[model samples]
Structure formats: structure tokens, C-alpha cells
Target: MTNAMWTHGVEWLTAATPDPRAGERAWLPGDGTVLMEAGRHWDLVSVPRQLGLLTLDILWYDPARTPGPTLVDSAAHRVGFLVPPDPAGDWSGEGVRHASRGAWVAVPPPHRTARSLEWIVPPDACTALHPPVTLRLALREAYETLAVLAPVC
Candidate 1:
């Protein structure tokens, strides 16, 4: 069976900040900003934003599955956005695998969870990273694709 687009009920979300030293700060984007179809959920895996030529990686929770309180790491899955490096190039299964290298953000589960790995983009690592503009466009397109894949009704 084809993958069913998830549209979960979201309550709150925290966005990335412009401050570099602040690392990650939690700020609720407010209630009801996210709307997914029944049995489906929206998880903000990563938000690609720039800060002084450096891109920041932000993680978000799906509104539909977020319980009344803090959702445990075990209960959460890292959502991902896949973009083709070459638009005209073949994007078959192999291409998808090759492009998935450092292109993803590693979010680990909690200690009570599996104690998975945790990785973040270092501030000095932007030099080796791709251009900010290109990454931004790719991320935007990925998000749009996610929205389309999600079932509205």
C-alpha cells in the first residue's frame, strides 16, 4: 500500500531563533497553526534558516501526536525532507540514498528512550556546507512537497 499522508492535530510549536549563542530556544508558535488530516501528523523535522552566513537547524514536534504535556523522544520520529541536488539528474532509489548523507539532521531520542545519537551543525562548519541560498530554496520546496503528500481531508 502507498504511504498515507499524515495530518495530525497540533497544539504548539517552537521555532528557531536568530541568536547564534542562544543555541536552541523554545517558543510556542501558538495553538492551531498546524492542521493535518485524520490519523496523520505534522512533524517539523528541521527548519533551515540562516544567521550571518551560517544556517541553523531547528527541530519541531508534530501537532497531531503531541500530547497534553511534553512528548517523549520514544514517541517521536524524525521527519525528513529529501531534495535532489540535480533537478535534471535521475532521482531513483540510489540517488535518494546518495543525497541523504550530511543532508539530514540527527536528532536523538531521550535517555529514557533509546539514547540514540545527537548531532548538530557546528558554527564553524558552514564553510564546508553548501550555499545558504541553495539550501533555503531546497528546504522550502521540500516543505511544500510534504504538505502536498499529506492528506487534507
Candidate 2:
């Protein structure tokens, strides 16, 4: 989506910030990205960049399973998927980092899609954060797909 099209999605993401107005001023224009805390509105499922991208492709291609907002940090080689809060901290995907409480994530304004950090799928008003099980299964699928594709000795 174009930067102009993401205005509403940007607002939805910014509302998660500790200081919504400050986040707007800092990242919305020329300032850079902002950090929003995890576990309040939702938690995070942090995945390796490549695998996450694979999973993203899988999810996006399937019209029945459009995931929630996803953020990618190319420099860090990390991708984070937003999921509903895990009050029990029971998410146990093989390699996923489920950030519940006391964790934060860097979120880029959607206008900066060309930047190191940007949205893979910008959030809208209608959807809920990804279900942990769905994200976990997709991640596992990505990993297995990669394993099969690798050149073997």
C-alpha cells in the first residue's frame, strides 16, 4: 500500500505507543521510528527474517488467512508478528520469541516502507492480532520448507 493509503493504519499503530502524540511527531514525519510496548494491547512473535518472510508469503497468498500487522527489521534480520496478549505465557513455538510483558518493539511509520523497519502488513480496524497457533504453524512450515530447499552435501 502507498504511504498515503496507510494513514489510518499508522494511526492505529501509533496509538500503541507510550506517548501517541510523541510517537506521531517523532516517526510520522522526518524523525524516525518509535518503540511501542508489548503485552498491553497485544504480544509479539519474533521470528528470523528469512523464515518470517517465507511465512508472510504463505499467509498473504492465502486469502483465508490474512495475518495481523507485521514488522520487519532488515538490519536486525528479525521480523515480528503481532498477536493477542498471552496472559499465561504459554506460547512455545520451537524458535519463536514470544514477547509478552516487559518487552518492546521498534515500529516504523508505514510511510517509511523503504526504510530498515516497516510494515509487511499494515493493521486495519477490523482484524484482531494473529492467533499464536496460526503464527506458530506458519513459522514451522517456513522452517521446514527452507530445510527442504537447502543444498545438501
**Candidate 2, pairs of clashing residues:** none
RMSD of each: 18.2, 2.4
Question: Which segments of candidate 2 are over 4 A away from where they belong?
Answer: 1-5, 91-95
TM-score of 1: 0.24
- For every model shown, what is its TM-score relative to the native structure? 0.24, 0.84
Judged by lDDT against the true structure, how good is candidate 1? 0.25
lDDT of 1 at 52: 10
TM-score of 2: 0.84
What's the lDDT for all of these models?
A: 0.25, 0.77
| Cα misplacement distance, residue 97 of candidate 1 (Å) | 26
**lDDT (10s digit) by residue, model 1, range 61-132:** 223321111121222332222222332333222112122322323222111122422223211111122332
